[model samples]
Target chain A: MTPDKLKTILLVEDDDKLGRQVRSHLTEAGFEVDWLRHGHDALAADPSQYGLIVLDLMLPGTGGMDVLKHYRGQRCDVPVLVLSAKTDAAIKVRALDLGADDYMTKPFWPGELVARVNARLRRPLANAGDSIEIGRLRLDQSARRLFVGEESVDLTRVEFDLLLALARRPGVAVERGWLAEHVLDPERDGTGRTLDVHVSRLRRKLGDRAVCLQTVWGVGYRLEPDA
Target chain B: MRLRPRLALTALLAGIPLIAGSVWARSAIERSNAVDGLTRLVLQRMLDGGRDECSRWPESWPIPSGPGMGPGMGPGMGPGMGGEGMPTWEERQTRMQAMLRGGGGPRAFSHLGPPVEFFAYSADLTSRNRLAPALHEDLRTGLLDGRKVVSRGRSNDSDSPLEIAVRMDWFDEPESPSAIVLARQVGASEFGLAREFLWGVTALVSVMLLTLLLSAGPVVGRARRLTRNVRRSATDQYATSIPVEGSDEISELALAFNAAGAQCRAHTDLLEQRERSLREFVEGTTHDVMLPLTVLQGHLTSLAKTSSGEQAATLRDAIEEAHYMTSLIQNLATTAKLEAEDAPPRRDPVDLVALCERVVARHMPVGREKGVRVEPVLPGDPVVVRGDETLLEQAVSNLVHNAVRYVDRDGRVLVVLSAESGRFSLRVLDDGPGISPDQIGHLTERRWRADDVRARHPSGSGLGLAIAKEVALRHTMELTLGTAPELGGLEADLQGALG
Candidate 1:
């Protein structure tokens, strides 16, 4: 996969300096990032164009919860990761219940934030059929088919489980602990390093479509829908 | 009556009889002296009149014979005696002897011995007579003067002639000597004057006694009333209060008592106000401290969630510190709230066993990390109590936290909740080094630390048990600390909230 093919993300944050720092980091990581200072601007823009939305809960003009409501209400279905300074469980539950794809308490690591955004954008489209599509990539659950722009690719059982985990919620970061618990056998002591090896093998099988599998530093892998 | 007035009245009343007796004695002495003087005057006047009459009537003139006459005189007399017919000296002498002796009739030559008796009178006055010769001489001198002599003689049987001295002055001047003598005796009436003087003196004394008795009545009555008023005022001032009706001393005393009572009430009110203000100050200060402490605790919890590596370690320490500060502030607030006079417990029915289990679970993580085991012995049936749920939770949490923090890693901490009789008890027992007998004395004091224990461990702000103790007291429950039997560590028991 080439760096130019990486999907763009819109980051809405009230803290100006922290937002710029995060944008620069993501930019340097070979991904285009657009930073919005308030929730209103993020909600006004076409959120469908962006691969992912990273919303800060405490924002001016409109709150993260309100932006989430507006997006979900309109059925835009853009993956959103909520960031907040409130660590209380009730707040996290409320944010999630309000259609926020994921919740993160601050002062969160920039790497973790990027990883979650990547994972959220990579989530596959929901349908009753066996095949799942996220942008140009598709996985046929029954046929065990993987395609990148209409060409089919074969995957092993471990590769399929890994891809399926990432595809279940595209563009949302799946923590190594979650992957290990859901994908690997319990008897296998598969560390995060081992999960990294499996993701690398899966990325090589689908060329150019491999751009969706993004490496978020100091955190687990994320899959982004191709832009 | 008061002592002073009663004393004064007694003195005044007593003075009356003394004054009356003194005055009566004085008057009686004066009357007796006057009587003596009148008697002397009457005797002298009689002697002088008799002598003058005898001398005026040559020898006899038949001496007056009425009640006013001389001693031997009779009612009837001869014509010569009536007319002042100058009878001779011998005849007059014979008539005088007849009058004196009554031996001779009213005729001439009554006795011839009169002349012989007169010749025997030449002897010395005291030598030859049983009676004094001077007295005899005086009687004779009065007869020779043709005066009827009247004296208080010793006896009539005396061998001495009576001498009489008489002057013819009044008889010749047409002033009859008998009339002069009668007038002198009436002027000098001794017995009648004495009797009349005594009657006048008795009347004066009676009047004085009556006056004293009459005046004493009102004076004594007024004094008694004044005394009674004063006594009542004094007693009322001490026991209750008296109305000041007038501007008298008793009224003044009542006013003073009222003023004193007012001052006492004012002082009491001031003291109560001061106490209330002090209590409010304490409550406000503690409440103010608690607000920031709660905010700090929240911030610490947030800090613990975000940090990593050494920063996480530092944040954890900060969180513990904040928690300690919150516990201390909460203890102070609870103490202040409980100390209020009208503090009412917010009681609700709660399951003691569930509460204890929750508290034990809260401390279980810390206990597990320290390798300590928390054993909760709960009743099969719920042990229900009517109490403040939050405060009771705080109480049980403190006990469990204390046990978890103090006991060794391998030690066991047991929490038991049960209902016995009508009381519900929640007890926490630990098997670490039990509190020493000496340390137990200062265990509940805020910030108290045991000397023998390691200082590195979480030395509680020492408010946990204190807060629990206050909560128990507020609920009208009992909280006690003792050594667990087999565990040999501190055991805290919270009992009551029965119904």
Candidate 2:
């Protein structure tokens, strides 16, 4: 099935304004919104009916943790994105440990929230194929090579891994720190600056098509389709 | 200066006078008994001369006048008279006086020791012998009143004479003394007083020291025990108190210490309670504040997305103000948590690599909006350090956020975590107009902003660097500020040991 096709999103939040805005945003993002104001209602509802659950930690009655625990206890595999005003790392870790798929601190942008919801509902990109293409920049995963339009681009192992990591999630900002640890060779100094070097070299090799490989500034790199 | 030595010294000091007084009193008594016995012995010897010698002198003899009693007559008219007729009264008297004065006349009593000599004084207290030794007036008066008198005679040597005078009645005179016998000890005693004094002092000191040791042993022991217990309690974090024993001063000290220890424990408990409540309040305030702020942010985001031109820009500024408020609240909460000074940060192994990532991620949107490029330079593997994760995250977040806030638009900010030479170094570097070297030192001062930023960023509380510095200090790490070597902007470096 197509990822955005008539999926239902369950939103459990206490604050009226915040919950309404989030529901409206999710609706605009082409998802059916089933909003609940209390944690008990969320717990009572069947988690399997929804494609995703947006849980707020501070809820009236049952509490978000309890609901999360209940859902997880039932072995429901739906993705849960925890929204909390408590920015403490321990709580975030706790929610994650309770099978939360994602965590977003409060005072977040509606746009960002919508993006997270969609990203969670999207199919795992690994199943798509061995290759990922964004505009003229294409990556062949099995062959470990990249191509820009009709010409093949030469890439070092580090540069290839960096581009492949970004190309897997086109238009989405990945953290530079994550790219450094995962894409760069562990034996080498895979620091953010080191990752930056690899990205720069990869962009240079992309030549005129380098415009499609975008830097997300405070975030990491993003592969965009060139119009 | 410690308890044992102090007690011993005090014992010695107190023992001195008692020992000296005992020795002095014993010596005085022995001296008096010696003088009395010597007087009796001398008097008995004089009396042992018998009735013939005692009756030789008439009851009230007239004074004898001598025409030639010089040295010439002394040799010719020897004490024996040399077979001549009995010596005249004048010659006999002179010879007797010379002998009594130890002038080497005749030995009237050969049985007595050589130092012994005596002569007679008439009833009127006048010596019949012209050369008799001069008597003290007190002794003479004491003799005339029928009282035996003993006195210590002043002399230039340590061996002073013990002199005595007694009444003698002779020739049927029963009511009054017809003569007085004056005698004195002429030689030192049989034992040297120096040796006696040495023995006395040695004995006294030995007894005193032994007594002091026995008496002060338990006191010192108790004092030592108290000292040890006090130290142990301190090492035990004042969780335990010294036991009180006995009714002595040491016990009093123990009681005082126990009270003080109890007070300290109570204060610690009160402080812990206060800290817990304060942390709760800060957390609650953070939650309450964030709820509204989040709603505000959502509305602003919606507005800015739909608006255009000036309206969009203003909405963007409003969103940034909300973000600044969020960060300020976070810093305030962190500051509140840090106020519990005695509580050590949680010792979980924190990954600096992930930490830098989260910090960069958290600030990414704001950085993108400001056109500032905030990035992380981390190691490939996790660089783990032991600390409280939340505090560490906040510290790093502050560093990155501060760099993003002050750095100009289109500038680059880097959060670099480097592990080299077995050391973990975290640095936040930016490529914008950096603080002057002078201002760098003040950057970490709470609420102190660079003079240049106040005009453009008037709302900046300047608490970011300060909070980061505090977190680093709590973790036993060093937070240093300087110009970035590569980026040429402000570089905040946190150096710590690799976990």
- Measured by lDDT, the strongest candidate is 2
Expressed as tens digits, the lDDT of each residue in A100-211 for candidate 2 is 8877777666765776765566434433567776777778888888887767877888888777766655555455766776787877764667777777787788888788
Predictions in order: lDDT: 0.57, 0.70
TM-score of chain B of each: 0.44, 0.71
Interface RMSDs of the predictions, in order, are 16.8, 5.3
Q: How do the residues B256-308 of candidate 2 rate in per-residue lDDT, one tens digit apiece?
A: 99999889888988988897896798778887888788788778877776899
Q: Which ten residues in a row have the lowest lDDT in candidate 2 chain B?
A: B60-69
Q: Alpha-carbon error at A202 in model 2, in Å?
A: 5.3
lDDT of 1 by residue, B70-148 (tens): 3433333444454344455565555556554432121222222222111111111111212212434444455455563
lDDT of 2 at B331: 72
Best by DockQ: 2
